[model samples]
Target: MQDHISSLNIAPMHSPWIEFRPNRPDAQARVLCFPYAGGSAQVYHALARGMPENVELGAVQLPGRWDRRREPLLTRLSDA
Candidate 1:
């Protein structure tokens, strides 16, 4: 079953999922963000302001919120 799906362009997402906005490939550094409970990746949308040009940012959306709501919630902090 999995093999059949792999034949297509579809691919599974890896963990600590990041948003798919246009990325800054030349960035010297990257930021991995985690919002407070009940918050979504959108919280960091405005965080780019005033940051250095070499800095890039990525936000992690916890389960049960935003687009990932269909997924299960993190039952433990370490699991997040």
Candidate 2:
């Protein structure tokens, strides 16, 4: 299996939140993946289950979508 997938560090203007499924601890390495624009970390919910035995999958859930649907959507990519 690959050594890693993807990871990102987001410092939001306000509070940020993260979520994940149950995970087991082992000698395997952990990988965090980020989704593309309009994408959400929930998409990777299965990653923790379908990932290789030696790899851990984690996803990033950015605000402004599903959870923040009430929030205004940004049009310009840079504005997001």
Best by lDDT: 1
- For model 1, the run of ten residues with the poorest summed lDDT: 5-14
Cα TM-score per model: 0.65, 0.50
Q: What tens-digit string does per-residue lDDT give for candidate 1 at 10-80?
A: 23234547762335665555667878878998888888554566566778878888888898987998986
- Candidates in order have lDDT scores of 0.67, 0.58
Cα deviation of 26, candidate 2, in Å: 4.8
Candidate 2 per-residue C-alpha lDDT over 1-80 given as tens digits, one digit per residue, 9 for 90 to 100: 23243233222222334444435344245566777888877788876778766555666666676676677766776854
Candidate 1 overall lDDT versus native? 0.67
In candidate 1, the residue pairs with backbone N, CA or C atoms under 3 Å apart (3 or more residues apart, or in different chains) clash, namely none
- Evaluate model 1: give its TM-score: 0.65
